[model samples]
Target: LLLDIVRLKGSHSAEHIRNTTEQILDHLSINDKVYKIITDNGSSMIKAYKFGLSVSDQNFEDEEANDEDSMDVDEQIGY
Candidate 1:
């Protein structure tokens, strides 16, 4: 069982969610490749990601995302 916990402030839109998720995935890929990633019931994240939730598969995998290195500019400025 592997999981990457993402702490998001307030809420997000679908486009915003995709952008954020992509950033995390890109960072994670630097260390190790992942078969899939998962997130909770947040509307934006859930709708934007293809591999959201459902960790019942045999191929479930995880890799830590270096969020500190690639922070979201919009989020930092309160967008």
Candidate 2:
């Protein structure tokens, strides 16, 4: 996923966030599957909730468990 942020002096941050979120949701809802998502470290985006989808924290866990089933089972053990 690509996040395009336009610098507009007068626009509200919430408006931009809302528009972007809606656009992303619309596109993703129609597509086959949403594998992963990327967003900047902004206040609005940081609070994004994971609804049982695969989310990458950009840190490699291990080499052996790359698949979802292994990752899910291993994540609990790690915690």
Candidate 3:
């Protein structure tokens, strides 16, 4: 569903896209309810959702560690 359409007046970099998406989710109070986001194969889109939404206060290091752990688990399970 299309909830809102915001008009931005600046460069649409990865940071800008991510910030705008976060703002919209926060404004709707659905940050915790989001599971996945679909976007085109643009570079900015890929970078914006590289770590998913910042639903909590997790730092980049923590996310990297978690990703490593998941990879290990997947490797062990022959995934």
Q: Write the per-residue lDDT of candidate 1 for residues 1-79, one digit (tens) a residue.
A: 4535577666677777766666776777632344455668777666776555333344342122334324566578876
Q: 1-79, model 3: which lDDT tens digit per residue?
A: 7767998769989999989988998899997766568889999999989988755545555667889999999999999
Task: Give the C-alpha lDDT of model 2.
Answer: 0.52
Candidate 3 overall lDDT versus native: 0.83
Candidate 2: TM-score? 0.33
Task: Name the lDDT value of residue 26 in candidate 1.
Answer: 72
Clashing pairs in 2: none
Stretches of model 1 off by over 4 angstroms after superposition: 1-11, 51-79
The C-alpha RMSD of each candidate to the native structure, in angstroms, is 14.7, 8.5, 5.7
Whole-model lDDT per candidate: 0.57, 0.52, 0.83
- Model 3 scores worst on lDDT over the 10 consecutive residues at 54-63
Please give the ranking of all candidate structures by lDDT, highest first, separated by commas: 3, 1, 2
How does model 1 fare in lDDT? 0.57
User: What is the TM-score (0 to 1) of candidate 3?
Assistant: 0.63
Full candidate order by TM-score, most accurate first: 3, 1, 2
Q: How many backbone clashes does candidate 2 have?
A: 0
